[model samples]
Target: MPDPILPLQADQIGKTYRQGATTIHALRHVSLTVEQGEFVAVMGASGSGKSTLLHAIAGLIDVDAGRVVIAGQDLSLLTDRALTKFRRSRLGIVFQSHNLLPSLSAEDNIRLPAESTENLDQEIDDLLDRLRLSARRNHKPAALSGGEQQRVAIARALICNPAILLADEPTGSLDSVTGAEVCRHLRELVDDQQRSIVMVTHEPHVAMWADRVVVLKDGNNLAEFVTDGRRDPQSLAKEYHQTLEGEVVR
Candidate 1:
């Protein structure tokens, strides 16, 4: 049998920006692949290109070089309109801020991506139940807790049934306890639902929940390691620090 196609494959992705006289290389030949049902965390310090890589893979911004293939479709080849449609159907994104509309209820928020609400009612209902937001489905963003809001955001992202979920600082806004709750939800999405996730996070505790951690430094791939949920957050943090220190020494 042929090798299975990955849910996400970013190859030699490079992006640069010019600010006055200086050139900022936000990403440099950064390549990553995420398998189906796998949770991969991209961990980096500020300006380490972690978010840039996520944007590149999601086609939120154009990369100066390299290509991002999602489910065998090359993102760079699509027209802007086509890309937007493709993204709506194929990609799910969650951000640090819950990004929920205050005016809409949680169920309405999750139904935003569907073209027709009539057809998606059952799907949305099932998704809300799965996300454990059934009771809070009618609540507005202001009425929900931080964790609930984020869970609603996740439900919204998943309502489309996208091939992979791209999360940027997904647990950044929550307290430690709430953040852990959100992380466990994401892990369940991978292990139970066979969903793939590529999350960009600076928190070691959050990254520890992933199947593997990919570290970025100075706009390049620094190192990667499998976590297997065996190691503690402190050990992961120490390893991440050592990886950066080693890169600096070299």
Candidate 2:
């Protein structure tokens, strides 16, 4: 049998911020591992360290303790410049805000990341078409709907052909119908492209899209709920809510 591969891994990670005498612990000994081609969701309430954990794993912030590895490279050993190159080449990030440039068209937005590549055009229209944004390729961020803008962001992230994609509250700003649409698009990308995703979200509906769900609270990973196959989101949401309620009672 072939050795299993992991795109991202975190071990005993912790982060703390000192505001005068009051020290706030943002992530508390959180540990997570994402295998290759797996879509895993990290779910938590506000201030439950979901974003903090994402930042730590993405190497956007320094952790006071523990270590992180991305694409088999030990992040702790890399210098700042090397780390930046490593991240730019292997990790993709999508935010809730869509973060598209106002002046760039949707196709241009998706191709921006490819500029850093060595003689690679990466066919913007093909990507746009796959994302169902081909018709909207000429539109700018201001011209597109919220769901359309997020799809552009996803196309941009995937344009790099990165080893892993990190998404934080990707559907937090969208309406219910639009959010579901975005989720379907994400599923297509992951299933067809063999892309691994580590997503942070509060919505159980969003979390259910993942192959496995990791529950986080008080700065640590608590549990995992996985389905036998691809389970229905509606049923998964009911169980997730019940699991959350039980946690509250304990």
Q: Which stretches in model 1 have alpha-carbon errors above 4 Å? A: 116-119, 247-250
Give TM-scores for every candidate, taking all chains together and pairing residue i with residue i: 0.96, 0.91
lDDT of 2: 0.84
Top model by lDDT, which number?
Answer: 1
Expressed as tens digits, the lDDT of each residue in 1-250 for candidate 1 is 9989889999999999999999999999999999999999999999999999999999999999999999999999999999999999999999999899999999999988876566598998888888899999999999999999999999988887899999999989899999999999999999899999999999999999999999999999998988878438998888888888884332
Worst 10 residues of 2 by lDDT: 115-124
Candidate 1 TM-score versus the reference = 0.96
Stretches of candidate 2 exceeding 4 Å from the true structure: 115-122, 229-234, 245-250
Please give the CA lDDT of all the candidate structures: 0.92, 0.84
